[model samples]
Target: MSTTQSDRLRGLLEPLVDAKGLDLEDIELSRAGRRRMLRIVVDSDEGLDLDLCAELSREISDKLDETDVMGEDEYQLEVSSPGADRPLKEHRHYVRAVGRLVKFQLAEGGDLVARIVDVDDEGLDLEVPGVKGRKPTARRIAFTEIAKARVEIEFNRKDKKEEEA
Candidate 1:
Protein backbone atom coordinates (compact mmCIF):
# COMPACT_ATOMS: atom_id res chain seq x y z
CA MET A 1 0.00 0.00 0.00
CA SER A 2 0.96 3.65 -0.29
CA THR A 3 3.03 5.37 2.40
CA THR A 4 0.37 8.04 2.79
CA GLN A 5 -2.26 5.42 3.57
CA SER A 6 0.08 3.68 6.00
CA ASP A 7 0.98 6.95 7.73
CA ARG A 8 -2.67 7.93 7.95
CA LEU A 9 -3.57 4.60 9.44
CA ARG A 10 -0.71 4.88 11.91
CA GLY A 11 -1.81 8.32 12.98
CA LEU A 12 -5.37 7.13 13.36
CA LEU A 13 -4.51 4.00 15.33
CA GLU A 14 -1.54 5.06 17.46
CA PRO A 15 -3.62 7.15 19.84
CA LEU A 16 -6.18 4.43 20.20
CA VAL A 17 -3.39 1.92 20.94
CA ASP A 18 -1.65 4.29 23.40
CA ALA A 19 -4.91 4.86 25.19
CA LYS A 20 -5.06 1.13 25.79
CA GLY A 21 -1.53 1.05 27.29
CA LEU A 22 0.23 -0.59 24.32
CA ASP A 23 2.50 0.25 21.44
CA LEU A 24 1.54 -0.34 17.85
CA GLU A 25 4.58 -2.20 16.61
CA ASP A 26 3.61 -2.67 12.97
CA ILE A 27 0.83 -2.55 10.37
CA GLU A 28 0.65 -4.28 7.04
CA LEU A 29 -2.00 -4.21 4.34
CA SER A 30 -1.75 -7.00 1.84
CA ARG A 31 -4.03 -8.54 -0.72
CA ALA A 32 -5.28 -12.00 0.13
CA GLY A 33 -7.33 -13.32 -2.81
CA ARG A 34 -10.20 -10.87 -3.37
CA ARG A 35 -9.95 -9.33 0.10
CA ARG A 36 -7.25 -7.27 1.76
CA MET A 37 -5.71 -8.32 5.05
CA LEU A 38 -4.71 -5.68 7.56
CA ARG A 39 -2.51 -7.10 10.27
CA ILE A 40 -1.78 -5.06 13.36
CA VAL A 41 0.89 -6.08 15.82
CA VAL A 42 0.65 -4.54 19.27
CA ASP A 43 2.64 -5.05 22.44
CA SER A 44 3.25 -3.68 25.93
CA ASP A 45 6.07 -4.01 28.47
CA GLU A 46 3.80 -6.27 30.50
CA GLY A 47 3.35 -8.48 27.40
CA LEU A 48 0.14 -9.36 25.59
CA ASP A 49 -2.57 -11.87 26.52
CA LEU A 50 -5.49 -13.27 24.56
CA ASP A 51 -8.00 -11.04 26.33
CA LEU A 52 -6.04 -7.91 25.47
CA CYS A 53 -5.71 -8.94 21.83
CA ALA A 54 -9.45 -9.52 21.58
CA GLU A 55 -10.18 -6.19 23.21
CA LEU A 56 -7.73 -4.31 20.96
CA SER A 57 -9.14 -6.00 17.88
CA ARG A 58 -12.67 -4.91 18.76
CA GLU A 59 -11.59 -1.34 19.51
CA ILE A 60 -9.54 -1.06 16.34
CA SER A 61 -12.38 -2.48 14.24
CA ASP A 62 -14.80 0.06 15.65
CA LYS A 63 -12.35 2.94 15.02
CA LEU A 64 -11.73 1.81 11.45
CA ASP A 65 -15.42 1.53 10.76
CA GLU A 66 -15.94 5.11 11.91
CA THR A 67 -12.92 6.60 10.12
CA ASP A 68 -13.36 5.52 6.45
CA VAL A 69 -9.58 5.03 6.59
CA MET A 70 -9.47 1.95 4.38
CA GLY A 71 -11.72 3.26 1.61
CA GLU A 72 -14.60 0.91 0.80
CA ASP A 73 -12.47 -2.19 0.28
CA GLU A 74 -13.38 -5.28 2.22
CA TYR A 75 -10.53 -6.23 4.53
CA GLN A 76 -9.69 -8.61 7.33
CA LEU A 77 -8.14 -7.26 10.50
CA GLU A 78 -5.85 -9.44 12.59
CA VAL A 79 -4.44 -8.14 15.83
CA SER A 80 -1.73 -9.97 17.76
CA SER A 81 1.61 -9.79 19.57
CA PRO A 82 5.06 -10.18 18.11
CA GLY A 83 5.69 -13.84 18.55
CA ALA A 84 8.85 -15.43 19.94
CA ASP A 85 11.93 -15.06 17.69
CA ARG A 86 11.09 -11.50 16.58
CA PRO A 87 14.30 -9.58 15.85
CA LEU A 88 15.89 -7.64 18.71
CA LYS A 89 15.99 -4.17 17.14
CA GLU A 90 15.34 -1.58 19.82
CA HIS A 91 17.00 -1.29 23.24
CA ARG A 92 13.72 -2.25 24.88
CA HIS A 93 13.69 -5.45 22.83
CA TYR A 94 17.07 -6.37 24.26
CA VAL A 95 15.98 -5.39 27.73
CA ARG A 96 12.97 -7.68 27.48
CA ALA A 97 15.32 -10.47 26.36
CA VAL A 98 17.79 -10.01 29.21
CA GLY A 99 17.29 -13.47 30.67
CA ARG A 100 16.94 -15.36 27.41
CA LEU A 101 19.35 -17.08 25.03
CA VAL A 102 20.12 -15.01 21.94
CA LYS A 103 22.00 -15.53 18.72
CA PHE A 104 23.98 -12.47 17.80
CA GLN A 105 25.53 -11.89 14.39
CA LEU A 106 28.54 -9.73 15.16
CA ALA A 107 29.51 -6.91 12.86
CA GLU A 108 33.17 -7.64 13.40
CA GLY A 109 33.02 -11.40 12.97
CA GLY A 110 30.97 -14.59 13.33
CA ASP A 111 27.86 -15.62 15.22
CA LEU A 112 27.69 -16.12 18.98
CA VAL A 113 24.96 -17.86 20.93
CA ALA A 114 24.91 -16.49 24.45
CA ARG A 115 22.56 -16.15 27.36
CA ILE A 116 21.88 -12.49 28.10
CA VAL A 117 22.90 -11.71 31.67
CA ASP A 118 22.24 -7.99 31.55
CA VAL A 119 21.52 -5.02 29.29
CA ASP A 120 22.20 -1.32 29.46
CA ASP A 121 21.91 1.57 27.03
CA GLU A 122 25.35 0.94 25.59
CA GLY A 123 25.73 -2.81 25.52
CA LEU A 124 24.94 -6.22 26.96
CA ASP A 125 26.64 -8.69 29.28
CA LEU A 126 26.33 -12.17 27.87
CA GLU A 127 27.25 -15.53 29.33
CA VAL A 128 28.85 -17.55 26.54
CA PRO A 129 28.21 -21.20 27.17
CA GLY A 130 31.30 -23.32 27.60
CA VAL A 131 31.91 -26.55 25.79
CA LYS A 132 31.72 -29.89 27.66
CA GLY A 133 31.70 -29.30 31.45
CA ARG A 134 33.67 -26.05 31.36
CA LYS A 135 32.36 -22.94 33.04
CA PRO A 136 30.51 -20.39 30.96
CA THR A 137 32.45 -17.20 30.31
CA ALA A 138 31.13 -13.67 30.46
CA ARG A 139 31.49 -11.45 27.41
CA ARG A 140 30.68 -7.80 26.88
CA ILE A 141 29.39 -6.72 23.47
CA ALA A 142 28.55 -3.22 22.43
CA PHE A 143 25.36 -2.65 20.46
CA THR A 144 27.45 -1.36 17.58
CA GLU A 145 29.08 -4.76 17.32
CA ILE A 146 25.81 -6.49 16.61
CA ALA A 147 24.55 -6.70 13.05
CA LYS A 148 21.55 -8.86 13.94
CA ALA A 149 20.16 -10.57 17.00
CA ARG A 150 17.15 -12.67 17.96
CA VAL A 151 16.03 -14.63 20.97
CA GLU A 152 16.56 -18.37 20.80
CA ILE A 153 14.11 -20.78 22.31
CA GLU A 154 15.48 -23.29 24.81
CA PHE A 155 13.51 -26.47 25.43
CA ASN A 156 15.60 -28.24 28.05
CA ARG A 157 16.64 -25.16 29.95
CA LYS A 158 17.77 -25.21 33.55
CA ASP A 159 16.73 -22.55 36.00
CA LYS A 160 19.48 -20.23 37.23
CA LYS A 161 18.49 -20.78 40.87
CA GLU A 162 18.60 -24.54 40.41
CA GLU A 163 22.01 -24.30 38.79
CA GLU A 164 23.27 -22.24 41.71
CA ALA A 165 21.85 -24.65 44.25
Candidate 2:
Protein backbone atom coordinates (compact mmCIF):
# COMPACT_ATOMS: atom_id res chain seq x y z
CA MET A 1 0.00 0.00 0.00
CA SER A 2 1.08 3.57 -0.68
CA THR A 3 2.29 5.51 2.36
CA THR A 4 0.03 8.47 1.51
CA GLN A 5 -3.08 6.31 1.40
CA SER A 6 -2.13 4.53 4.63
CA ASP A 7 -1.50 7.84 6.38
CA ARG A 8 -4.77 9.27 5.13
CA LEU A 9 -6.69 6.23 6.32
CA ARG A 10 -5.00 6.41 9.73
CA GLY A 11 -5.90 10.07 10.04
CA LEU A 12 -9.51 9.37 9.24
CA LEU A 13 -9.93 6.32 11.46
CA GLU A 14 -7.71 6.95 14.47
CA PRO A 15 -10.03 9.54 15.99
CA LEU A 16 -13.05 7.31 15.56
CA VAL A 17 -11.27 4.40 17.25
CA ASP A 18 -10.01 6.63 20.06
CA ALA A 19 -13.55 7.79 20.73
CA LYS A 20 -14.54 4.16 21.18
CA GLY A 21 -11.82 3.63 23.79
CA LEU A 22 -9.66 1.39 21.60
CA ASP A 23 -6.33 1.54 19.84
CA LEU A 24 -6.16 1.12 16.11
CA GLU A 25 -3.60 -1.60 15.71
CA ASP A 26 -3.45 -1.76 11.91
CA ILE A 27 -5.28 -1.14 8.64
CA GLU A 28 -4.91 -3.05 5.42
CA LEU A 29 -6.60 -2.65 2.05
CA SER A 30 -6.50 -5.64 -0.24
CA ARG A 31 -8.44 -7.33 -2.99
CA ALA A 32 -10.61 -10.25 -1.96
CA GLY A 33 -12.24 -11.80 -5.04
CA ARG A 34 -13.84 -8.83 -6.88
CA ARG A 35 -14.33 -6.61 -3.83
CA ARG A 36 -11.83 -4.54 -1.96
CA MET A 37 -11.35 -5.70 1.65
CA LEU A 38 -10.45 -3.11 4.25
CA ARG A 39 -9.32 -4.81 7.45
CA ILE A 40 -9.12 -2.70 10.57
CA VAL A 41 -7.55 -4.33 13.60
CA VAL A 42 -8.32 -2.73 16.96
CA ASP A 43 -7.17 -3.47 20.51
CA SER A 44 -7.82 -2.32 24.07
CA ASP A 45 -6.13 -2.81 27.42
CA GLU A 46 -9.30 -4.46 28.67
CA GLY A 47 -9.56 -6.59 25.50
CA LEU A 48 -12.29 -6.56 22.82
CA ASP A 49 -15.57 -8.42 22.46
CA LEU A 50 -17.85 -9.19 19.54
CA ASP A 51 -20.36 -6.51 20.52
CA LEU A 52 -17.67 -3.83 20.59
CA CYS A 53 -16.41 -4.97 17.18
CA ALA A 54 -19.90 -4.76 15.69
CA GLU A 55 -20.42 -1.26 17.07
CA LEU A 56 -17.01 -0.08 15.89
CA SER A 57 -17.65 -1.51 12.44
CA ARG A 58 -20.92 0.37 12.17
CA GLU A 59 -19.33 3.63 13.34
CA ILE A 60 -16.39 3.25 10.98
CA SER A 61 -18.67 2.42 8.06
CA ASP A 62 -20.76 5.49 8.80
CA LYS A 63 -17.68 7.69 8.92
CA LEU A 64 -16.38 6.25 5.66
CA ASP A 65 -19.69 6.85 3.97
CA GLU A 66 -19.44 10.55 4.88
CA THR A 67 -15.92 10.86 3.50
CA ASP A 68 -14.29 10.44 0.08
CA VAL A 69 -11.21 8.83 1.59
CA MET A 70 -11.82 5.47 -0.06
CA GLY A 71 -12.86 6.95 -3.41
CA GLU A 72 -15.71 5.36 -5.34
CA ASP A 73 -14.69 1.74 -4.91
CA GLU A 74 -17.13 -0.62 -3.25
CA TYR A 75 -15.26 -2.11 -0.36
CA GLN A 76 -16.02 -4.41 2.56
CA LEU A 77 -14.86 -3.12 5.93
CA GLU A 78 -13.80 -5.69 8.53
CA VAL A 79 -13.28 -4.51 12.07
CA SER A 80 -11.67 -6.93 14.52
CA SER A 81 -9.18 -7.28 17.35
CA PRO A 82 -5.59 -8.41 17.00
CA GLY A 83 -5.11 -12.16 17.13
CA ALA A 84 -3.32 -14.10 19.88
CA ASP A 85 -0.11 -14.43 17.83
CA ARG A 86 0.24 -10.76 17.04
CA PRO A 87 3.81 -9.49 17.20
CA LEU A 88 4.92 -7.47 20.21
CA LYS A 89 6.02 -4.28 18.50
CA GLU A 90 5.30 -1.52 21.01
CA HIS A 91 5.85 -0.98 24.73
CA ARG A 92 2.09 -1.20 25.22
CA HIS A 93 2.08 -4.56 23.46
CA TYR A 94 4.70 -5.87 25.86
CA VAL A 95 2.80 -4.52 28.86
CA ARG A 96 -0.39 -6.15 27.65
CA ALA A 97 1.37 -9.51 27.17
CA VAL A 98 2.58 -9.63 30.74
CA GLY A 99 1.83 -13.06 32.29
CA ARG A 100 1.58 -14.57 28.81
CA LEU A 101 4.15 -16.85 27.21
CA VAL A 102 6.21 -15.22 24.49
CA LYS A 103 8.91 -16.31 22.05
CA PHE A 104 11.68 -13.83 21.53
CA GLN A 105 14.42 -13.70 18.90
CA LEU A 106 17.42 -11.91 20.36
CA ALA A 107 19.26 -9.34 18.31
CA GLU A 108 22.62 -10.51 19.62
CA GLY A 109 21.87 -14.20 19.16
CA GLY A 110 19.61 -17.10 20.16
CA ASP A 111 15.90 -17.46 20.99
CA LEU A 112 13.99 -17.53 24.27
CA VAL A 113 10.55 -18.73 25.21
CA ALA A 114 9.41 -17.34 28.53
CA ARG A 115 6.48 -15.96 30.42
CA ILE A 116 6.45 -12.21 30.77
CA VAL A 117 6.49 -11.25 34.43
CA ASP A 118 6.93 -7.49 34.17
CA VAL A 119 7.62 -4.72 31.68
CA ASP A 120 9.12 -1.23 31.71
CA ASP A 121 10.24 1.35 29.20
CA GLU A 122 13.67 -0.20 28.95
CA GLY A 123 12.85 -3.93 28.88
CA LEU A 124 11.04 -6.90 30.40
CA ASP A 125 11.47 -9.29 33.29
CA LEU A 126 10.79 -12.81 32.09
CA GLU A 127 10.37 -16.09 33.90
CA VAL A 128 12.26 -18.56 31.76
CA PRO A 129 10.95 -22.11 32.10
CA GLY A 130 13.51 -24.57 33.29
CA VAL A 131 14.16 -28.04 31.94
CA LYS A 132 14.17 -31.55 33.52
CA GLY A 133 12.26 -30.67 36.70
CA ARG A 134 14.39 -27.63 37.50
CA LYS A 135 12.72 -24.49 38.80
CA PRO A 136 12.00 -21.59 36.48
CA THR A 137 14.61 -18.83 36.38
CA ALA A 138 14.10 -15.08 36.17
CA ARG A 139 15.87 -13.15 33.46
CA ARG A 140 15.85 -9.59 32.23
CA ILE A 141 16.00 -8.74 28.53
CA ALA A 142 16.40 -5.26 27.15
CA PHE A 143 14.16 -4.17 24.32
CA THR A 144 17.23 -3.39 22.27
CA GLU A 145 18.28 -7.03 22.56
CA ILE A 146 15.01 -8.33 21.15
CA ALA A 147 15.05 -8.73 17.38
CA LYS A 148 11.43 -9.88 17.33
CA ALA A 149 8.80 -11.18 19.74
CA ARG A 150 5.32 -12.65 19.63
CA VAL A 151 2.89 -14.12 22.12
CA GLU A 152 2.79 -17.90 22.21
CA ILE A 153 -0.53 -19.63 22.60
CA GLU A 154 -0.70 -22.18 25.39
CA PHE A 155 -3.47 -24.71 24.95
CA ASN A 156 -2.94 -26.80 28.08
CA ARG A 157 -1.44 -24.39 30.54
CA LYS A 158 -1.68 -25.17 34.23
CA ASP A 159 -2.21 -21.51 35.03
CA LYS A 160 -5.14 -21.37 32.64
CA LYS A 161 -6.76 -24.38 34.32
CA GLU A 162 -6.16 -22.88 37.76
CA GLU A 163 -7.70 -19.60 36.64
CA GLU A 164 -10.81 -21.43 35.50
CA ALA A 165 -11.11 -23.12 38.87
Candidate 3:
Protein backbone atom coordinates (compact mmCIF):
# COMPACT_ATOMS: atom_id res chain seq x y z
CA MET A 1 0.00 0.00 0.00
CA SER A 2 1.10 3.55 -0.72
CA THR A 3 2.22 5.67 2.23
CA THR A 4 -0.58 8.21 1.80
CA GLN A 5 -3.27 5.53 1.70
CA SER A 6 -1.79 3.68 4.65
CA ASP A 7 -1.46 6.87 6.68
CA ARG A 8 -4.99 7.92 5.73
CA LEU A 9 -6.36 4.58 6.79
CA ARG A 10 -4.45 4.74 10.11
CA GLY A 11 -5.66 8.25 10.71
CA LEU A 12 -9.23 7.22 10.01
CA LEU A 13 -9.32 3.90 11.85
CA GLU A 14 -6.93 4.33 14.77
CA PRO A 15 -9.28 6.49 16.86
CA LEU A 16 -12.10 4.05 16.38
CA VAL A 17 -9.87 1.26 17.63
CA ASP A 18 -8.53 3.37 20.49
CA ALA A 19 -12.05 4.23 21.59
CA LYS A 20 -12.71 0.51 21.92
CA GLY A 21 -9.54 0.03 24.03
CA LEU A 22 -7.46 -1.76 21.41
CA ASP A 23 -4.18 -0.93 19.70
CA LEU A 24 -4.09 -0.81 15.93
CA GLU A 25 -1.22 -3.13 15.17
CA ASP A 26 -1.35 -3.00 11.39
CA ILE A 27 -3.44 -2.33 8.30
CA GLU A 28 -3.01 -3.84 4.87
CA LEU A 29 -5.01 -3.08 1.73
CA SER A 30 -4.30 -5.52 -1.03
CA ARG A 31 -5.79 -7.25 -4.03
CA ALA A 32 -7.45 -10.62 -3.64
CA GLY A 33 -8.17 -11.85 -7.15
CA ARG A 34 -11.17 -9.76 -8.27
CA ARG A 35 -11.78 -7.78 -5.08
CA ARG A 36 -9.73 -5.72 -2.66
CA MET A 37 -8.96 -6.96 0.85
CA LEU A 38 -8.51 -4.75 3.87
CA ARG A 39 -6.92 -6.57 6.81
CA ILE A 40 -6.85 -4.77 10.13
CA VAL A 41 -4.76 -6.34 12.86
CA VAL A 42 -5.70 -5.17 16.33
CA ASP A 43 -4.27 -6.04 19.72
CA SER A 44 -4.48 -5.17 23.42
CA ASP A 45 -2.30 -5.67 26.47
CA GLU A 46 -5.08 -7.86 27.80
CA GLY A 47 -5.33 -9.78 24.53
CA LEU A 48 -8.37 -10.18 22.22
CA ASP A 49 -11.36 -12.45 21.81
CA LEU A 50 -13.50 -13.50 18.86
CA ASP A 51 -16.56 -11.50 20.00
CA LEU A 52 -14.49 -8.31 20.20
CA CYS A 53 -13.07 -8.83 16.72
CA ALA A 54 -16.56 -9.38 15.29
CA GLU A 55 -17.77 -6.14 16.85
CA LEU A 56 -14.75 -4.20 15.63
CA SER A 57 -15.30 -5.55 12.10
CA ARG A 58 -18.81 -4.16 12.12
CA GLU A 59 -17.68 -0.76 13.35
CA ILE A 60 -14.84 -0.53 10.81
CA SER A 61 -17.14 -1.62 8.01
CA ASP A 62 -19.62 1.12 8.93
CA LYS A 63 -16.88 3.73 9.05
CA LEU A 64 -15.52 2.67 5.66
CA ASP A 65 -18.99 2.81 4.13
CA GLU A 66 -19.36 6.39 5.32
CA THR A 67 -16.00 7.53 3.95
CA ASP A 68 -14.53 7.83 0.45
CA VAL A 69 -11.18 6.60 1.65
CA MET A 70 -11.80 3.26 -0.02
CA GLY A 71 -13.35 4.93 -3.10
CA GLU A 72 -16.62 2.98 -2.81
CA ASP A 73 -15.05 -0.20 -4.07
CA GLU A 74 -16.43 -3.48 -2.75
CA TYR A 75 -13.61 -4.68 -0.55
CA GLN A 76 -13.52 -7.34 2.12
CA LEU A 77 -12.77 -5.84 5.54
CA GLU A 78 -11.12 -8.35 7.89
CA VAL A 79 -10.47 -7.38 11.50
CA SER A 80 -8.36 -9.75 13.56
CA SER A 81 -5.50 -10.14 16.03
CA PRO A 82 -1.92 -10.70 14.97
CA GLY A 83 -1.07 -14.38 14.81
CA ALA A 84 1.62 -15.91 17.06
CA ASP A 85 3.83 -16.50 14.00
CA ARG A 86 3.80 -12.83 13.03
CA PRO A 87 7.23 -11.18 13.27
CA LEU A 88 7.78 -8.93 16.29
CA LYS A 89 8.53 -5.52 14.77
CA GLU A 90 7.54 -3.05 17.48
CA HIS A 91 8.85 -2.53 21.00
CA ARG A 92 5.34 -3.06 22.29
CA HIS A 93 5.24 -6.38 20.45
CA TYR A 94 8.34 -7.53 22.31
CA VAL A 95 6.92 -6.32 25.62
CA ARG A 96 3.74 -8.27 25.00
CA ALA A 97 5.73 -11.38 24.21
CA VAL A 98 7.52 -11.33 27.56
CA GLY A 99 7.31 -14.74 29.30
CA ARG A 100 6.82 -16.38 25.92
CA LEU A 101 9.37 -18.48 24.04
CA VAL A 102 10.80 -16.69 21.04
CA LYS A 103 13.14 -17.70 18.25
CA PHE A 104 15.43 -14.93 17.17
CA GLN A 105 17.40 -14.52 13.98
CA LEU A 106 20.54 -12.61 14.98
CA ALA A 107 21.73 -9.75 12.82
CA GLU A 108 25.29 -10.97 13.27
CA GLY A 109 24.64 -14.59 12.30
CA GLY A 110 22.96 -17.63 13.93
CA ASP A 111 19.63 -18.07 15.74
CA LEU A 112 18.76 -18.11 19.44
CA VAL A 113 15.73 -19.72 21.09
CA ALA A 114 14.94 -18.30 24.49
CA ARG A 115 12.16 -17.23 26.80
CA ILE A 116 11.75 -13.47 27.17
CA VAL A 117 12.17 -12.56 30.84
CA ASP A 118 12.14 -8.77 30.58
CA VAL A 119 12.21 -5.92 28.08
CA ASP A 120 13.67 -2.47 27.99
CA ASP A 121 13.85 0.27 25.34
CA GLU A 122 17.32 -0.95 24.44
CA GLY A 123 16.85 -4.72 24.40
CA LEU A 124 15.56 -7.89 26.06
CA ASP A 125 16.68 -10.08 28.99
CA LEU A 126 16.25 -13.62 27.89
CA GLU A 127 16.47 -16.97 29.71
CA VAL A 128 18.19 -19.37 27.42
CA PRO A 129 17.11 -22.90 28.21
CA GLY A 130 19.68 -25.37 29.45
CA VAL A 131 21.22 -28.19 27.49
CA LYS A 132 21.97 -31.73 28.77
CA GLY A 133 20.72 -31.01 32.34
CA ARG A 134 22.65 -27.76 32.73
CA LYS A 135 20.86 -24.77 34.26
CA PRO A 136 19.36 -22.07 32.07
CA THR A 137 21.49 -19.00 31.37
CA ALA A 138 20.63 -15.32 31.28
CA ARG A 139 21.50 -13.31 28.21
CA ARG A 140 20.74 -9.83 26.93
CA ILE A 141 20.07 -9.10 23.27
CA ALA A 142 19.91 -5.59 21.94
CA PHE A 143 17.11 -4.74 19.52
CA THR A 144 19.77 -3.99 16.92
CA GLU A 145 21.02 -7.56 17.22
CA ILE A 146 17.65 -9.04 16.32
CA ALA A 147 17.39 -9.39 12.56
CA LYS A 148 13.95 -10.99 12.95
CA ALA A 149 12.02 -12.66 15.75
CA ARG A 150 8.73 -14.38 16.43
CA VAL A 151 7.05 -16.07 19.37
CA GLU A 152 7.50 -19.80 19.31
CA ILE A 153 4.49 -21.98 20.06
CA GLU A 154 4.95 -24.69 22.69
CA PHE A 155 2.23 -27.30 22.69
CA ASN A 156 3.54 -29.63 25.38
CA ARG A 157 5.01 -27.15 27.81
CA LYS A 158 3.46 -27.24 31.27
CA ASP A 159 2.54 -24.14 33.23
CA LYS A 160 3.40 -23.72 36.91
CA LYS A 161 -0.17 -24.41 37.95
CA GLU A 162 -0.27 -27.57 35.89
CA GLU A 163 3.08 -28.68 37.23
CA GLU A 164 1.94 -28.15 40.82
CA ALA A 165 -1.23 -30.14 40.28
What TM-score, computed on C-alpha atoms, does each candidate reach?
A: 0.90, 0.93, 0.91
| Tens-place lDDT digits, model 2, residues 1-165 | 556877899999999999998999999999878789999999999999999999999999999999888999789999998999999999999999989999999998899999999999899999999999999999999999999999999987667468889
Best by the lDDT measure: 2
Order of models, best lDDT first: 2, 3, 1
Evaluated at residue 108, the lDDT of candidate 2 is 89
Lowest lDDT 10-mer window, candidate 1? Answer: 153-162
lDDT of 2 at 97: 93
The per-residue C-alpha lDDT of model 1 at residue 81 equals: 91
lDDT of 3 by residue, 58-85 (tens): 9998998888999966799899999877
Residue 144 shift from truth in candidate 2, angstroms: 0.4
Cα lDDT, all candidates: 0.92, 0.94, 0.93
> After superposing candidate 1, which stretches have Cα over 4 Å from the reference?
1-3, 158-165
**TM-score (C-alpha, index-matched) for candidate 2:** 0.93
For model 2, which pairs clash?
none
Candidate 3 has an lDDT of 0.93
**What are the per-residue Cα lDDT tens digits for candidate 1 across 1-165?**
556888999999999899999988899999989899999988888899999899989999999999888999899999999888889998988988877899999998899999999999899999999999999999999999999999998888786687899
Q: List ranges where model 3 is wrong by over 4 Å.
A: 1-3, 159-165
* Stretch of 10 with least lDDT, candidate 3: 154-163
| RMSD (Å) per prediction | 2.6, 2.3, 2.3
